[model samples]
Target: MATIPEPANATVQAVYRLHEQRDAQAGHRAHLGASLIGHPCTRYLWLTWRWAHKEAFDGRMLRLFEAGRQFEARIVAELRAIGVQVSEVDANGRQWRVNDHGGHFGGSLDGAALGLPEAPATWHVLEFKTHNAKSFADLKAKGVQAAKPMHWAQMQTYMGLTGMDRAMYIAENKDTSELYSERVAFDPVEFERLRARALQIIESPEPPPRISNDPAWWQCKTCAMHPICHGEQAPLVNCRTCAHSTPVMDGAGGWRCERHNTAIDTGRQHSGCAGHRYIPLLLERIAEKVDAWDEPGGNAAVRYRMADGAEFVNGAPPHFSSVEIRAAKHKAMLADPQVQRIKADFPDARMVA
Candidate 1:
């Protein structure tokens, strides 16, 4: 059983605060992760791949993530004690990897094991997790597939990738420190379906249809993409978020800028080029794009009319450039004479968020 954390002294509080600070500054994932691919919402997956929102966690949540990883090691030791032969590292001395889609999608296995009493001759993928007391009880009552489809999908994916027929899923109750284990059989149909979905999310230029348009839908409200998806905020400006950029056919998570005819390395993707164009769908709800025209050097000037009747142009700008539209305050600044003066006088001055 676990007890509540004791009241911290100044020194301990500083340590906790530092964890939160570090977590907040952590960068987003470069590739869509296999662990997250099991989520029900494809639009959420698409937005995440487009770098729509970077997740930040508080200190307690950060610590909980560390605890889950630590629990994996303990479970590995306990499994060995029970005569299950396990290997945490592959031939290259790394946790066995489950890779797919040219390495753009996959995750590290908790480990791989053999010699389970039920199937002593066969190998099984290992998946370890820690659940709260209530969650553990629910899992025990309903079994893994019905109780935790994400975990079930995760195991199926790992097994499918590694050519394993079975997986050993072990979960520990955080409150009671009790363990529950289940053996999962690979479902070929589900794994292929998941892989196809992942490919669709990685390659799409715009977000897939949202699971629900209603912001109040419980799932949508809790999603990280909620603000952008619901039109409360503009999508972040980056090469991946731009209409001109696309995933390269090459399996490596590489991107290409169609406007510039150049490959966009990760660094260039962060600070998108001047040619960046917002995919029209990004602003469709808040603003209807009224007109568009071609500019020199393959620039496409996009014009939009906000619901409130404010009109703005994107790239062929002596107007609001793609960068300026990112800030809600700047959206209303569109027809302001000062904006015209600034764009006219400085030619180089651009907005930053």
Candidate 2:
């Protein structure tokens, strides 16, 4: 018999490239996910909620995400195979969802199940996860609560919202194919605390305080929001980060543009209007919006004072536009003392480039 032929290396490369392309086109999630609500950094949460940064996952990372997703389906199937009664979706055939804060904050649950040896008759919120060997070892050594507080918070929120008193967390080790399961009880106090944290993130007009002022903090170093949170980088341009826009303080999960007093759908939010102005705090490191610095979170065009003591406006004729301010973040010429004087003198001129 003839031996089967192996696929060429180019085929493998092509597959990864396709993954990269798909990720490149992926849009950022609109809601603040409940799964991430437990993260200790408030500033990171706010920046993510406000589209202060964009995700640029490489092909390898994208593939890892896909692997974890694939693992979830397998885990569900295996659980059902072992005589466990599992319900992965609600009546609508959609993944069970938990919504709060006017729908601005929520997450989709893995599933619910019954028939575990410890509590055969009771139902449990199901949480599935995949971890590498090192992470798996630590999880076993420390137990879920001590080693994975975020995961603990996640299960608590799910059980509390879904009306379950307990949760089953099952993690698979990628290296050894080892499995670890833990039963977690819901904490009402922790649930309420998580609820309050979500509300605080959704309602506040400005980004929440950073966990540390030091940029070198290890946690800060690994965060996606690192550049904008610590470095001099400006946030991505979008309505969510604009001075005129804000998340509605309700369960509507909607955004509003104060300048126009109109509802902003996700499409319009991604493509901010010409009236856009950077939220005062977003540019605090580069320039200060002198006129509206005292404004809670939103304000119209205003005066700006650069670090070198030059002045300019952010809106109307003679002042730079929001786009220009973002562009200036990249080009030194935009903030040059001489150019500021030129603009001050030409008051009528505009930087079109």
Candidate 3:
């Protein structure tokens, strides 16, 4: 066998430079949009582009993300138990690297499971999904209907990057206490077709259209740029009398406006309405409209209404009685110098109706 020399730093640098050039030429963000969601709608594509570059997770959220990693570990263990030889490769330095031309498509597998014995080596790329049973059931009931285009494209892209013939999704539904697995195979022809579409979306000046097929309401809630992509609506403000209003759970927790107080079943678990209400103020300063009304028992209320049909109300206390005023006036009249000084401290007040 002939000895081969390790590549020099100059070669590695050249490779990296090439990768950057390809990424820039392909419009990497738009490429990401196409590969993930198969949609190039300007808003959706741009939102996805921004999300791919965002680092909004905190330490607490990172800890929660480790749960999925643990699940992946368990799935690896299971694959090893089934007599499959598993090993991780330094994919970044690997030779025979798969190139998509755009440089926006590549991923290193966690580990590749290879078959033994008489059968040809079957490369397996495993993906682990950990969720409560409710979520699993919802996805199952929807039958890929609820699956995000990005998710599907992600798995497919992995297969392409790794040159794997097949991939598996091992899902553990913690709530249902059940484990499920699904196998997916790569279709080179289909992969090429998708890749072309993605490239076209990336090169085009316009965005792709909104996917009308998605039925999952949860997606709408968690999306970061939802307010910008979606339209503005009502803002939720806390109120003492409204049933939807609740006290803040902790000192650190902000006050729960009425919009957030509604029960989950009532579709109020998230504060979209309240958050949307402030969109105009956040995006641009606008003059607010005010409306006033009188209430029974000499009380009054002021309403600050926004163009979006959202309102904030403040109520006034009842007026003082005539007898009460008369007694106070008499006491002030009969006061000593010191008492008179005290009475003077309490300036006369008038009810403004």
Candidate 4:
């Protein structure tokens, strides 16, 4: 028999490349948005904030997103056809959004729905999701809260942010077209707990310890940030990831810097500033020696010797270059008297000591 031909590889490659390019152009988000608020691991949330990079979604995953979107549009159309009033986009052609109390966190809702049998003409937050056959069956059997706490928490947060008391959580099965829905009332207690937890993550200086002690744990194997979070790769530079920075009370009921003893604006916190330093955990594998030193006016420094045998006695070096340049810059910063004075004022400042 003649040799069987393979499928066209070029077409699939083109499709995958297009999706990859789109993913790259989207870039990383600066805020810790609502979708991730209910994730199981606090350490994962912290690592996300510290790194701010999305897991690389392959072509199949990207296509799944597109399918979910199409399903959303179809659901909206069906609702409209049934004389239900659902507006996915608001007056300005934008989705509805809400911010947390401190304005440090926020997210856009899917839509608002009205005239459901459960509510009888009252408006409620419309939260929609699509799942596969097995997942949808589980959702139908257990309902949202019992089967999926994350989705339940997300709806509660939406209600909390929008000051609404009710939300209609809808799920559709992609394979079977089966639909399941439940009206979830706002739980102030749950919302408050989630909100407080998110604030704690944003305010804490160091990330919470890893979720597991064993690197070979099942969860670790599936985690997208496994390499960087586990110290296999260098972490991205940011204030939250810095060794010398911690969030303190700003006194007006918001977060401030432990180092500067002042409120750091949101943008600076997200992207980092001139003073960014890699946290000690991230540097441990690469640093040869780290020492603690005290100066006048109650200041302290965690001096480091790079693996290359160069001495540098300061935090917050610029983008890494040759080991020699970074080491020399660190030495320069330590020698400056102004840097000395600046360090002295922050008695609360700390590092790996």
Candidate 5:
């Protein structure tokens, strides 16, 4: 039997639960942020932008984020004490916000600083980050460019949009209360490269390719959109990912499902129905097999090979040949030990074949 812990005061637990509930209700975002500029995988950014998968954080993680914000405020105060004039808002009385090559991509910078003897009172962007002892030490040693390229990209983008030439990068060690500050110069070449990357992500209809096929790659493991990128979590069932579904040749460019013999309206395609099936291409991309049958169709019943050369017949009585590929693949998937574990918790969690 599992050991049960003794109950403690309910007030703190209640507050944390309330925070989690509020965060969950915040809903999905529509645009990509400049903070993700240095992320290697554009597909991860695309999937997140399209809301293909959901991301969640537990109560403790949420509190950690909140604490980081508070740490920024403390850093700002310390800078002011040393005669560094920092202005968080712009001339119009709003916090400094910036964008990439196109206005469609942007993020709110931490703030901007002036009156620093190092920069001769020019308005230099201020970027603050909180880290633990180990992270803080590495950051201090390597500096922002080598230690945290994503942050470097973000600050550079901010500088490009706001027409600033430099920034004050600040880091605070949460564990030891030690601070490290560095002045980062803007690089026009790196700025253009980051902007081009953002444009590539925006113009592409399909997600960019995954960075690595291996799901266990350290970068992939820490990514927020790892499940969707690796195909571990089934993306929302849709006509785009279904083998039976295709775009109508008509000028209207509508969708249709060959199996159902019915026009698939936009609404139905966006949120797939119960009869949705997986495309063989998608299955193969996820490392699942869709082996072709070695034998020919006999008596109008087509046969297809599944994993390990297991043969399954299509067009046998009620089921049609169009769905044979998906049906066979689904059966093979369920037999896998890993999938069986998931089914233990969610008995109905079969692939939409």
Candidate 6:
């Protein structure tokens, strides 16, 4: 078991403040990076960088921020309406701090609410989420199936930090104008597991990779590393047996391959090669190809024929396969000219792949 960091102070309010600040900083970075990477797509690191730096915001980003604020305010109002004691609603007590790996981590919470008469005097650590009906439906579907690991881990992390046994997710579905309240309970066993995992992440030299397959286009489309991860000309392999297999168009702009199934017009990018061995040589080859494709008219597209006999155009499947290697396309439309320019200007950009 990894050593978990203890709160600097044992008081509920003290721990709450610390965890709140830490979460706030993390949330800020995550949102900023999500904005830059385009939502649903930005990686943790990208979001962190954008959040650390005060960059200019576009109208769309501004609207997103505004909507978030509005949602937060509404959650506060809901808590107040329920007659729960709301903390940190005022300016002075808004910020909190915690000890993280001997360094300081701080953030702010929306506010804490006490549950109603029917429920225990449980402290509700309220988390506000804004989603369209489609997104909400997706979540509900998953919950019906089984709680997602990430969501479970997230709520557990909050529980461990705040020492609260329960939390609530106040989700607003814009399309249906429906408010969905979901309650989550904390398991000490689960908290211990998450605490150990978080300690590992903090102690390790590298960050943990994002490990969800949520079919949200905004999540990947807005990722900063999408160009490197899912760029049209990126060198990838397709295999029928690999778990990452998805039907995708081949380089020839006709015929589909099962090995390449990941390229379907899902409107979202996903992590390919989940089980891929991180080989330097393979990475180098991919970098070289990305570089060649950056040159003027240097791009090529290949049409791949899949075992299913379906016709596909542009890009290969998400996985690498030993059973198939088909045609290559010289240039695909998805490859952006701006990206090519960036590659041309900074040859080292290939290393990012």
Model 2 TM-score relative to the real fold: 0.89
For model 4, what is the error of residue 193's alpha carbon versus the real structure, in angstroms, after optimal superposition?
0.3
Q: List the residue pairs that clash in candidate 1.
A: none
lDDT of each: 0.82, 0.83, 0.45, 0.68, 0.68, 0.42
Best by TM-score: 2
TM-scores of the models, in the order given: 0.88, 0.89, 0.45, 0.73, 0.68, 0.45
Error of 1 at 89 (Å): 2.8
Q: What is candidate 4's lDDT per residue for 1-353, written digit by digit as tens?
A: 99778777878878987988898767555556777888888888887866534578887789888889888888888888988899777778888877663554667788888888777778888888999998999999999988888888888888998788999988999998888889998899999999998888777666677788576788786788676665435555556666556544333224455655666655666566545556655555345336755445444445656556654454322212122222332434433456445545654432211
Q: Write the per-residue lDDT of candidate 5 for residues 280-315, one digit (tens) a residue.
A: 333333334344322233223333454565443333
Worst 10 residues of 5 by lDDT: 315-324
Task: Tell me the spans in candidate 4 whose CA falls farther than 4 Å from its real position.
Answer: 1-7, 89-93, 238-276, 283-289, 292-353
Across 50-130, the per-residue lDDT of candidate 1 in tens digits comes to 887677777778888889999998888888999989998887898797667766678889999999988999899999999
Q: Which residue ranges in model 5 land beyond 4 Å of their true spot?
A: 1-6, 236-353
* C-alpha RMSD of each candidate structure in angstroms: 4.4, 4.4, 22.0, 8.4, 8.7, 19.0
Clash-forming residue pairs, model 4 = none
lDDT tens readout by residue for model 3, 1-353: 99687767777567556655554343222124323544424445533432222324443444446677787777778777888776655446552223353443333345666763223367666556776767778656653224544445556766776678776656778676588666667767767766666555334333344443242445544554454334331222212212233333232222344444443211232312322122122111112426545567533444444455444333432222222222233222222344335434653533222
Residues 1-353, model 6: lDDT tens digits: 99879865557556455545544444222111111121222234422321212233444455556686798877777677877666655335544222232221213445556754436577866666777778778777665114334555555555666777776766777777687667778878866764454334333322234433342455655654443334433223322112222322232212122333434221121222323222112222132222111113322233333333322223222222211221233232124455446545764443122
Error of 3 at 317 (Å): 50
